[model samples]
Target: MAVSRHLLFAILLPMAAVAADFPPPLLIAHATVIDASGAAPLGDADVLLRDGRIVSVGKALVAPPDTQRIEARGRYLIPGLWDMHVHLLRKGRPEAYFPLLIANGVVGFRDMGGDLGFDEIARLRREIADGSRLGPRFIAPGPLLDGPYPTLPSITRVLRNADDAAQAVLDLQRAGADFLKVYNRLPRDAYFALAATARAHHITFAGHVPLAVSAREASQAGQKSIEHLFNVLFACSSQEDALMREKARALDSTDVDERRQLRAHYLQAVLDSYDPARAQALFALFACNATWQTPTLVQRRAYAFPEQAAPDAALLRYVPHDQRWRFDPGQDARLQGRDAARQTLERRYFDMDRGQIALMRKAGVRFLAGSDAPDGEAVPGFSLHDELAELVAAGLTPMEALQSATRNAGDYFGLGDTGVIAPGARADLVLLDADPRADIRNTRRIDAVILDGRLLQRAALQALLDQAAEAAAGP
Candidate 1:
């Protein structure tokens, strides 16, 4: 079957002046094309791009005189990757952050949530579209719309009641948000109010499954996507109903320590009582409601095995000095003077995360690969590659993992213009030094990155990284 007719947000990723320039066709000749649309690899094929769209993909297609040829006799060609769930800036400048994406062959990304003001977010996106910034195509929620009690009050828009919830949705959408991001503490009634209002405005509402609501109810209420697999894991556990009851009571507690103890106890209960049959039922509902899951298993694993995360000197160059703690294993609370009990819980959650992916696959529920980076103290550009590898480790085939980053995300967010290499798709392509199908890690071997029909040659791509490193080195 062909790709869906999902119309991308037009202004969401408007190409630069390269679109009007009608740059000469970029001929990637003699490459093995793994389109990521489940089509068999086209051995020794030529993929042509012109005017910001893929014009053709075939064997030995005629190379016009006006074309710039990339001799790819043994290389692999695929759609540029998308990081579906990311927090773009938890530490450094957006300037220092963007080039790392292109340098790593990530041409598109969804800013799951950020602290940037609405206009600032709009400005950054506009810069990318106008070719003024060397960043990936950005689509983000204006700011987080959280419950009255929020963890990050600076970036959060507090919704104290159902009326506040409804107004918050309208206000954020009007302020040029790509979607409404409902946060964890939102009451069930307020969460529904926001969802209903988002539906009325024809906007996408996504984020956490509120504390009082089950994943099934969120899916039923038109929650477009759920990030971090937040409450879904427990929602599928055998103790789901009981856990929900407990959570409702926990919210009323003024004692912070008491709440934490109760949370830890009940979470342990969830892992012990996990039921595959119940999981299958939740998966069925998720599939039925067309709600997508962005499983940021990387975050979960980082907490579970913080000792394994040694900072890389090379990758840290792109990470600002103050922001480097994000990559520090010592910073994770789960690892700081760990007890055997907490370790077991972390390990169980990590295993359950993989189990959830396998079950989601069996139930035919779609997934979007998200790094949940920056939030995980992840080094932005490199963390996405790690996320892909983690997806494969969890149970996805290389192509399946690639799809979660590409086609599945495109389908999820209606960024149909990108995430595929085909006639009329966006001309964002990545040429790898080796076939990623053979090993998903080969995706990291980017030989060249094509963005908006403009080629960034290997040397040019290296320069982007170098410049980012220099900027990040700033005091």
Candidate 2:
């Protein structure tokens, strides 16, 4: 899987695509358009795109003289999907994965955390932004802002106090970060200072609600989004204060036996303290504050059931054979080690996350669909489909699930010109072989992808996948 850069470029840089300096006018005729705005799909729709923007969308449209026509008579069309969380770090071979995003119709994604010194990451981001690169749009916080003693020292900016936190925010923004990503274990004072500094700089701060800050307080204080249901679960329980104190004490311990016992007690207390009323209040606060949620349910599944991470032939084709075997020791090695207690806790957390998601929706809390792609367990592109299915399983309708990856995603990132398929929106769309309304998994049946008006027909898309697989299975 150690591919030479020259070889990788040869395979991935499609000559035709690179040669097309200007996008052609394309007309997709007789397709079903699912706009993902809760409206019914329009049958036999004719869509027109010229120069990376949708020019016409209706029941009948005569193609322009220079238009390239595609007969999509029986196809279903939807706005392109977005993965709200991803990490295309250099170590992950981001170059090999961009095609996967286009192959799966993921046109936008967020790289939540990675090494700040990973120069290739920002270069790729710039390339995409400047339209020289073709793939998902990238939003990232260069590195994670963590407490004094960071777990991942190399990728972390250790902040000892509020002054350090404020300075870190300024430095990160100056370094080209789209937003600020705060990590767990950040001191209460430092986290708040980071938040305030980010606000002053007109940048949004999103990520884990530090363990020191309750979810309600985080929402009230303007934490933009909470990742992985981290603080929400504990903060919503009736035993919030007690559970938090116990969790804090347990986490601070060094002795193995004592920490294990305390963790067990804390988990049990969390399981028993489900409070619908408290959860309702918390969700209300989130809605009012416009705080978003990226549950990353796919990650939850990988943690709760590590056996599923076993890559089959199809999966291995996209991920390096060596990289496929390196994810078991992430969380105390609980997954690979198969610790029964950790499995039980992970499952509970997963189920609890589902419940919270249902309640959050009921309380009108907006959400975004994220796969945490290439994050050890989840596969890129494909995991977004899995996340949509998980959302439906968690009580969101197929439409609601789709919206999380579409409109909600666009709104979260303040990209108003995209997300919809109407005239004037960015012409990023997916042509499906089947109606996704019947089954969320139908989203995976991609027939074609319209990426920035560059039509990737089924055959071209397949070529992209094949190239990714070959790059992964290097000679």
- 71-141, model 2: which lDDT tens digit per residue? 99988999999898887664646657888988999987878887645366556655664566666766667
Off by over 4 Å in 1: 1-13, 16-18, 89-91, 245-260
Consecutive 10-residue window with the lowest summed lDDT within model 1: 1-10
Pairs of residues clashing in candidate 2: none
**Could you tell me how far off, in angstroms, the CA of residue 216 lies in candidate 2 after the best superposition?**
0.7
lDDT of 1 by residue, 1-475 (tens): 1211111443334664335655688998999988898889989999988888898888878867899998999999888888888888433568677888888888878787777776676677667767677778767776687777785778788888899989887777666677778887787778888888878777887888878789889999989888888888788777888887787667667876667677678778788888878888899988888888888877777777777665568778887777777688776543565577877777886787677888887778788878876767566677788989988888888999999887876787655666898898888889999888889999999999998888998899999999899888985
Candidate 2: lDDT of 253? Answer: 73
lDDT of 2: 0.79
In angstroms, how far off is 66's CA in candidate 1? 1.7
